[model samples]
Target chain A: MRIELAYFAWVRERMGTPGETVELPPAIADVAALLGWLAARDERGAATFADPHRIRAAIDGALAGPDAPLAGVREVALFPPVTGG
Target chain B: MIRVFVQAAPIDVGAEIDLHDAGGHGASASFIGRVRGDAGLTELFLEHHPAMTEAGLASLAHAAADRWKLGALTLIHRVGSMTPGETIVLVLASSRHRAEALAACEYLIDRLKTDVMLWKRESFADGRIAWVEEREDDRDRAARWE
Candidate 1:
């Protein structure tokens, strides 16, 4: 499936890309699996996902956990939480 | 009534807030968030996607209305470059009792921090610029409301 991935804050800095569209392999069924697969693609991805606990994910603008299904989501954003007041 | 605005100028929090007491609300609570001169920060810039930011603020206001039986609520957030000690955001809530108004004000700010689409960039004295990262404690605070 094709998905648009977005990054913010530290994740965007480390990845050097704010957003991108990509085709995911069939083995990637959910957010956790997708992160694991991406980490193996390059050093930048590996480092970004190095500490999942500090990272947060949103599927189609709604908060999602690592186990959340991404079957119907066309967009997923990853960031270092939010600090806006 | 709830009011939300995003502007480029300084926010006159007190002037923006006025209670006529059409029904005689007995309590009002206001919160103002200012840019802090972080010892580590030499300069700061704020950037936001206009449409997304408006949507974020509207959602926050709606949530506040749904959660609290409020007489009035106001939320103002500024966009663009801001200096240290400048106002960044303000929230006001009025209710029939102090407890509701105070709790609503706190809830609005807390949720805005986590759910808002706004972003801040800080420049350190060493010539490094970076986006502010969200704190775990802020998320925990918002979670309590959920």
Candidate 2:
């Protein structure tokens, strides 16, 4: 399935890009699997997803977890914990 | 109803709240975040991807409306270059009672800081740019609401 991926703050800095649209392999079943797939794609992806504990994910616009299903999601955002006020 | 505005100009939080409440609000609360010159920094520059920023703010407004009994809500966040003492963001909530308005205003600010997708870069006097990290206290504050 095709999905839109967005990066924010330091995550965008490390990734060197803000957002992208990509097609996922069938094996990429959930958020965690998608992260692993992305990491395997290149060194930058690996580095970005290196510390999942510090990273936050949002499926569509709502906060989500790594194990959350991405079956119908059109977008997934990955970024450091939010800090804005 | 909730209104969200993100601009590069100065934000007058008090005036905005007053205007919002002029219609017939009994209670109103607001939060104004300013650039702290004491961050060992000379100036601050904020950048955001336009579409994403709007989407993020819209989502935050929706959350606040769903969580509180609000009569009017407004959030204004500035971007681009800003000096010390300048406002960064403003959150205003109007309700029938002070408790609900206060809680909603706090909730809006807290969630905006912790969940929104805006980015700020601090430039030190020595010529360095750094991304602000998520504060531990912000996380704790957000947790209390959950």
Candidate 3:
């Protein structure tokens, strides 16, 4: 599957890009799996994906949990906890 | 009535208040959030998912309306670069009574703290830029509503 990823705030700074599209294998089933796959992909993702619990995910656009299924999502955003009011 | 606005410009309180349809309400309560100049904070850069942020707020406004029997509600949040004392967000609620209006306004702003997916990066006076952390207290506060 091909998924579009978006990074915001420190996640974007650490990843060095706001977003990218990547092809994934069938084994990557959820947001956590995607993070693990990203961490092993290369140096750019090493530190960013180091702590999966510290990051949040949004499937397509709405906020989702770490266990959120990614089967139909074309876009995923990873970022730190929101601090706005 | 529900009004949700997400923009990069500063919020105009007077204009926003004037724009609200206040026809059937006897009380209108508002909460304005402004950038803090304390702790050597110089600037704040806000980032949000365009479509999602608006949708998120609309849902929140709906929740507020349902909970408080709101006659009118307005929610606006600003993004991009902002300086200290600039308006960051505004929540206004109108009801037939002061208690409902005030409580709903509080609920809207309080709920926004944790539930809304908006991030902030701070630029300090010494040229240090840092992402603001989500406070446990905020989560605790949001949990109170649950």
Per-residue C-alpha lDDT of model 3 across residues B53-119, encoded as one tens digit per residue: 8888899999999999999999999999999999999998999999999998877787888877799
Local distance difference test, each candidate: 0.81, 0.81, 0.90
Candidate 1 at B6: error in angstroms?
4.5
Q: What tens-digit string does per-residue lDDT give for candidate 1 at A1-85?
A: 9999988767787899988998998879999888887788899999988777777787887778999987878998887766678
- Candidate 3 stretches greater than 4 Å from native: none
lDDT by residue (B37-85, candidate 1, tens digit) is 8866766666654355677888888888778788888889987788788
User: Estimated TM-score per prediction?
Assistant: 0.83, 0.83, 0.97
Cα distance off (Å), candidate 1, residue B15:
4.7
Ranking by DockQ: 3, 2, 1
Query: Top model by lDDT, which number?
Result: 3
Residues B61-127 of candidate 2 have per-residue lDDT tens digits of: 8777777768888888898889999999888888778898899878878777776767778988888
**Separate clash counts for every candidate:** 0, 1, 0
The numbered model that scores best in TM-score is 3
DockQ head-to-head 2 vs 3, winner = 3
True contacts kept of each: 0.67, 0.64, 0.84
TM-score per model (chain B): 0.91, 0.90, 0.97
